[model samples]
Target: MSPDIRDEAVEMWFGPQHVSAHGWAAKLTVVGDFIVECDPHAGYFHRSAEKVLEFRTFKQGPLVLERMCMLEAFLAEYPYISAVEQIAGVEVPERAKVLRTIMMEASRIHSLQFWWGQFSAELGLFAMTLWPWVDREFFLDTFEELTGSRHAVSFSTPGGVRYDFNEKVLKKLDRALQRLEQHLPKFKDMLLRSPTFRMRTKGIALFSYEDALRWGLSGPNIKACGVPMDLRKDWPDLNLAYDLVDWEVPVVDNPDHPGQSDAYDRMVQRFLEVETSINIIRQLLPQIPEGPIVDPKARAKTNRLPAGEAYGRVEGTRGVTTVWLKTTEKAQTPYRAKIRGPCFASYYSLKHLVPGSTFADFIVVFGSLDPYPGWWDR
Candidate 1:
């Protein structure tokens, strides 16, 4: 190589196993330590989610959806449940609606906590790891008490949730929210305020607002770019009971950068969302109505929706997670069923950010965008 050239461009793989590679792996073409191109790789874990759901009855489908998103089961489960309930023409009780909102926000916090922990570790903030997990127990405890499991929470049924809300779990949720709120500031101080984080991420991995719209980035990813595209606010499901709550959707912006989408902005938007989720949980618990959790008519697989089709979507912890289902009177099972996850769209956009940044910058950029391989590849 010439002296001016320094190093010839060579390809490198970052994870599926790299310690710093947060979610999955990516292939990178690098000149020295700088990446010239990037290709994110997934499918290391694929269970054929749609195919598994298609053959099962409506009541049994959530079991498969829950596994698709290991980090946020509610995101996958809610959309499928809503799709089936809509097709079945089952009315979700008012109590179930508020409870679902509580779980959704809780799950949102759960997902962010996991992301933050990994991102912090990537930034060499080992101390940051302990706090999120310490606080996470409160959320998991609430879930375990509610559903007898911590991770794969297949809690929602077709018409409504499988379990009823109890005073003890609500009390635990209340206490957990308080703990999370109190501890939230430490993350901001340790990571967001750290010059290292800002320097590494503030303007790196930019996705312009126009690009966000064109590429269909959703949730906090697009919201960070000032797109104002929250499914909860823009397309609220009746069962979501979003109308019952009073909270502003946060489209986080970097006042310093002005009309920009960067890794820092994305992280900040999700950070703001974490606080919003806490507030939502507090707002909802007092207002949850007292009634049966699920209609008896909905718990069974025999309940047939109209032969037509319906699509159900939720403002997932990730983004606007969706489910499409088609039914026919000729057979009890769904004729067609599938899920659409948000991470899939953002995956292709990786090369757009990866090239023109250093290899280390690639990790920060990828982690900030928070792509999940498992969400796709199925």
Candidate 2:
């Protein structure tokens, strides 16, 4: 409120050049090591993916969607595929349903592993960073063994999945899961029990359940506030095998801050997410029924969708991801496509979360949300 304080405020941009901020930037006004104002910027990584979707065929649409967040490629592409199946009235086979669920959960775990490492590194814990990344490569190896590509696997399609689970694919998946299980406990203790880690994250970026919902935050960010708002349970997809598995949604109800989540709560929430994904995959793997991998009429049904609009939604790695599609009668491509990526809200919330914190804790606030640039940029 004083003229001296106003005159001393310094403005700075936090990235597109910062090592941690790959394709995003934010402007912060600081006064004596404390942030006074924050402005989060987007469009640095935008490729106009929604416009590009209109030119690609229904089958090709998922491929484009996966690129938006390759860390969760299998989960990212499902919304588009689900929309196509709705318009086409295609039935996915039981085998494909189980396979899709398994791969999607695997993708979720892999994505969380990446976030775990990156968040640790952002806080200057370099040893914690490399540990999870080494484990993440096992999941990538499994994906490559199955689909011949790691990040952009193009595994799922409308009415079913493109690749069936072969013996080699299953073995690789088993290996990855086993490796993760063996090491996750040690890694959890290292971060969660560390006094230094707690000092940095415990009270940082605090948000209430009401504020989170108002800002449209979901997934672990909201779950950390003791709310079980996962689409996999709330709005179960008929084509996916989540109904076939018995697992509870992972949530972190921090007693220290009831109905609110701080940076440490979010960190604990992600660890729980990885565990739940593992449980889902383990249960579904053995239950894969003997049947066709895809519908026999999928090709004809999806070739030219009838005039209709459909919305597809999934509980993605970060939050609720969705694709709204419109098509004309006998159209090979969509009339219009709209994508809603969850990180848009998380990134925007920095304007509110950063101002009261010290300048050094900016990345702590951002990393806790587990935001991916492609999710917002696309």
By TM-score, who's the top model here? 2
Per-residue error for 142 in candidate 2, Å, reads: 0.4
Per-residue lDDT tens digits for candidate 1, residues 1-378, read 345443577877887776675457788877877777788777777778788877887778888888877678877788888887777677777888888888878988988998888887887777887789888889899998998899888888877788777888888888888888888897788888888778888788887778877776788888898878888888878877778879999987677766668988888898899988887887887898888888776656436656878898888776778889888874567888877888887876787877888777777876777767767677
Local lDDT at 289 for model 2: 97
Candidate 2 — which residues are off by over 4 angstroms?
Answer: 1-4
Tell me each candidate's TM-score: 0.94, 0.98
Q: What TM-score does prediction 2 earn?
A: 0.98
The pairs that clash in candidate 2 are: none
Show the lowest summed lDDT stretch of 10 residues, model 2: 291-300
Report RMSD (Å) for each prediction in the order shown.
2.4, 1.0
Model 1: residue 265 alpha-carbon error in angstroms: 1.3
Error of 1 at 188 (Å): 1.5
